[model samples]
Target: MSPPSATLPAIAVAGLAKTYGDVQAVAGIDFTVSQGSVTALLGGNGAGKTTTIAMLLGLLKPSAGSITVLGTDMLHDRHAVLPRLNFSSPYVDLPHRLTVRQNLRVFAQLYDVPGPKQRIAQLAQKLDFTTLLDRPAGALSAGQKTRVALAKALINRPELLLLDEPTASLDPDTADWVRGLLEDYRAERGATILLASHNMAEVERLCDQVLMMKQGRIVDRGTPTELIERYGRDNLEEVFLDIARGRGKAAQPAQAETAA
Candidate 1:
């Protein structure tokens, strides 16, 4: 089947490129994320996933090309468009000196969430953060911190959610819970998500489409099942390994192989 059209992507990128001094961080790449769908940007370190996201979020300028989020040009309408998006990354920490509740409150204020108290209460119940509210951010375990970060990301009721390893530090149960929560949020709000993750299983489970990057360029892309079938692999991990190890270019029939 053909990919979606280019009229108005929830997130649209074309000829996107970025360079720092002599190093080309992101070669010209193009992709479109449909509205209300989860799209995974998959790549290993230095694959330009972070650089691409930074440009989309208007945190970094692209050396070339254009990007539009929710039909608003990121470069020209950044001020008006920023409020419609929020980002969460496990590697990025919240304020260590503040308590969990304090951190949430600060962000809630920044987002101007109506009745911040009630919103906090609701998210606390949903995320099981009631007990950890008074604890300093630095004192929480990795999993706990991840939950708080996620809550902060959602406080804005953003149209576009950018998640970098949302489930990175959580145990299996908590991670599963977080995934379910994301599904529920998407269902209720029709939100679009751009996720970058190393967890291929999570990507397969959550993403409607996937963009695979290599050395700052998108070398391949498809749904998880499409990629798995195309690579003659049992799962996305194998596909990722093959690509990472320089075997991705080898021609193979698009058929599922027995699980290894």
Candidate 2:
């Protein structure tokens, strides 16, 4: 694929929706993630965060609407953009028998990364999983596996990175370290990161914008500070609680920021 126009948003979804039987997993939602920013998708369980991310990754076909990722149509031209993006989720497991290094090498090749071995080595060292590289993925502890998963997601140095609960299973110190690594990566590469996380503090710290979803629809969106102030709350967590509990002032449909 040719280079996308720099002015295009990293991700643009219009009237995006998905359903299963009688249940609508994601109601019509429209939003765009600006290029070179960290955007957080926040919601409680069954709120469509995962469903939306899956559609963005082209892992699940949307029942309606459209998704343009990195300026390429996801439904019809995903292959043209897939190489430019990667996703990580702790809930998804790697093959149990493959060693950490082996697993990363496989993903590296799939992304057509140059110097797969060197990229794997760089990631293992950067993620502090060098010692676990030879261990079977199933043999690693939860935190170890989380680090390895992150390494795999980053193997290709993708322009877009999607993460779900990125710091899950990590201790406080390690989680903070990982967050710093992500911040540095974005700073260096101007990468766009879209993450679904329950960790409010992490979102407040890393995200430039936040989209709050409830019942499959995006109910609110703004910078963390903007949301907090608008809700008259002390912090993002409080604002989140207000929205989740249906006590906060109702929000109008978001006009996604073109420059976050």
Candidate 3:
């Protein structure tokens, strides 16, 4: 794949907002993610990270703002661009009774991937799930399921990948392996990835930038190192702790930098 160029934004959001009858789930926010970048969306529960992702995927309508992916308006013309994007998370599941290969075949057909069997074979090998291909999906362990979900996500070779808690239930070693796979895929495809995760080390290791949210709004954004330095913390978890506890009063660190 060619190197990503910045002539056009891969993702752009302006005045993005979403509200429910009496509750605000995502307040108006704006940000941009460059092509071939891995950006992290982070926050404590109820922070609106998932809601924001849902909006981008056309799963939720924005009550107020606008979102554009690959120059296509997500709110109004997602169909034109949907095929270029894909998502994965442990919370999502395949058919319980289907064998892993069968589940993948169904999804491959959904995406209309050419050579479905070959594609599945490629993914199974790359993800190290070849041994589990004929096993019932429901019989797999949490870590195995995570790998299957990842293989499904990549079957389309998406230009834009969204991962929400991709490694939530994984052991540390398994999580690291998953992260490595993601990195390899991104490097090979020059894909744009947006990840919402609580794994501080993973984010610091893989993401080029991080956006921190709280109560439906983006409160801070920067490189992991930048946030750690600004918060005078040893690592992202400490910085996250400060923000979660309301100790980081200046959540918008774009205006100024303070020692950790």
Candidate 4:
């Protein structure tokens, strides 16, 4: 059966912009993620990917335009709905003195997650981190911490997950496991995921759709295959390179910025 028309997108943004004095960090860009879809946001170092995610999470107010999450205005109703979403990144760290279990418990409380202990136990087992649960977060290896961070992100059983280089710093084997775990979680829960990663292999392996951002705007978007074919490339990394280097016709001609 088709989804209900009134079923709100997991996320939606139109003409979103973020400015810091003279720096147009995120110029007007727009996109939507349907409920339960896994999408990748790809870009180079100075692309607007970080600013865009920050705006969507309500951490940074957009200078112009609007954002809707689960059908309501995020700018106005963020508190009412922010709990339904969560984010994970290797760059961020849990408190050094907190045990893995303690960290999970803290986030569970923040998210008002019911039966927090039981949820933590389940996540530890699922993520194969049961042995590390009682250890201080600072004691963990890079891969262990990555798994723990992912568990914390999942503690709320979020409807939407934002992952920023989730598998970063891990060895190839561990990264593969993390990717597989994410794939399973989304499959089992029908959750929406917004992934921001420079890992093209990971993107092609996990994302259903890809959006390429450059110089504060989205220049092109499509599935891995679509972009590969469009760019006449063998893989997503090649396509990403072509776009990042302005080598393809897909690059949109830069237009004058119009504040919303």
Candidate 5:
């Protein structure tokens, strides 16, 4: 009845709050991420973006409210939901002593992935890591490490992918390649991605919608085009500046940026 109430979103956060003593890291934020789309979280320093993501991944307990991922309530059924999600961050590291292939093997086993060898081979080929597989992870270049980290994230074919600064420290060419790869992955699998990034251009290119945060609160949200239009700017960077400068209301759909 009633169309079966529709399926739950890939991710749902309601009245979510988190506080560290006197510092309220996140306050009453709510949003939903539909299945098979990319959602970008944008924020300046100390905006609670990291804290919010930590909670979504079940790495931290929320001070209040609720979170659900893929129809499982995070607070009540985290163990059931965690296996369906995976995270990748350029700032984090795999074991330095392990070869790239070994590192992936470890995670594949942890996720109880079937056909681990075939899965690793497929991902290595798809992600251009065939040669690096045998190389020690710490010995690889920064860009190479990023690729390996991504490979680890995809090893299990997770339903929900969480990325924080995924392309950080990568050269423009390499970053573009990685973006293309992610786009292909999304198109192929219809997976949901929640990305936290400072690269506005990349965000505009990859994200269908965005949540903008400031000082631990979600200050605004919309599609890239919607926010740009609302802020009277040609791009997201200017819109970000406007919000940071306390001029969020001045953003109008008609204002456009001058070419540099």
Candidate 6:
């Protein structure tokens, strides 16, 4: 892989907004994700986390603002950069009738991944899903499906990976194992990861930076330690509750630095 740009963020959003009729889904938020770092996007339901990610993926057009992904304008040039990134979400399911291997092969082809068969084999072995590769997707349990989804996300070795509730439906042991895979993937490939998860422990363990959202805007952002100290919390879960419930106001430091 080429050296990452010193100046450009892997993802840069300025004044990003999305609206549905009279309701604002995302209210002109601005943030940057550094290359080769793991960042978490935390928010309660209806906080616009999903909307923001959709806009980033060009699945939904922004009402107002700009999105530059990997130095390409996502609004006008999304196709050029789409292949460089991949996303995984439990909400998005693979074709039910397709076998696990078939699904992976299809995605690998879409991403133009070289050596698709070898790549699929490697992922199946690493994720410990080799036995399920030939099973129909609809026949797999939730945990098994989650692993398959993750494998599809990694099929192309994307430079930018966006994951939503990556460990949903996973057993504790398997979840930990998957997290290890993610850590290794980032270190070995120098990939940048943005994950949205309700599992605060998972966020704290995997993330280097945290972006907290409320009412469609970024309310605070910092290292996990910084937010914990600022919010006077023992863990990210506590800080999350403090922010989500309006127990604490956005800090001066975050407000000064962030465009909310």
Candidate 2 vs candidate 3, TM-score winner: 2
lDDT of each structure? Answer: 0.86, 0.89, 0.88, 0.86, 0.86, 0.90
Give one digit per residue, the lDDT tens place, for model 1 in 81-154: 77778999855799899998899999999888899988988888999989999999999999999999999999
Point out where model 3 deviates above 4 Å: 1-5, 248-260
Q: Residue 231 deviation, candidate 6, in Å?
A: 0.8
TM-score of 3: 0.93
**lDDT (10s digit) by residue, model 6, range 30-75:** 8999999999999999888888888999999999999998999999
lDDT of 3 by residue, 97-134 (tens): 99999999999999999999999999999889999999
Ranking by TM-score: 6, 2, 3, 4, 5, 1
**Would you estimate the TM-scores of all the predictions?**
0.91, 0.94, 0.93, 0.92, 0.92, 0.95
lDDT per residue (tens digit) for residues 1-260 in model 5: 01112356888899999998998999888889888889999988788888888999888999999998888889988888777789997657999999999999999999999999999999999889899899999899988888889999998888889999889889999899999998988898788899999999999999998998878777778899998987788899998889777775534433322210
Clashing pairs in 2: none
Residue lDDT tens for model 2, 1-260: 56656799999999999999899999999989999999999999989999999999999999999999998999998998888999899668999899998898888888889999988888888998888889999999998988888888888888999999999899999999999999999998899999999999999999999999889988889999998878788888987787787775543223223212
Candidate 5: residue 33 Cα off by (Å): 0.9
Model 5 score (lDDT) = 0.86
Q: After best superposition, candidate 5 residue 234: deviation in angstroms?
A: 0.5
Which candidate comes out best when scored by lDDT? 6
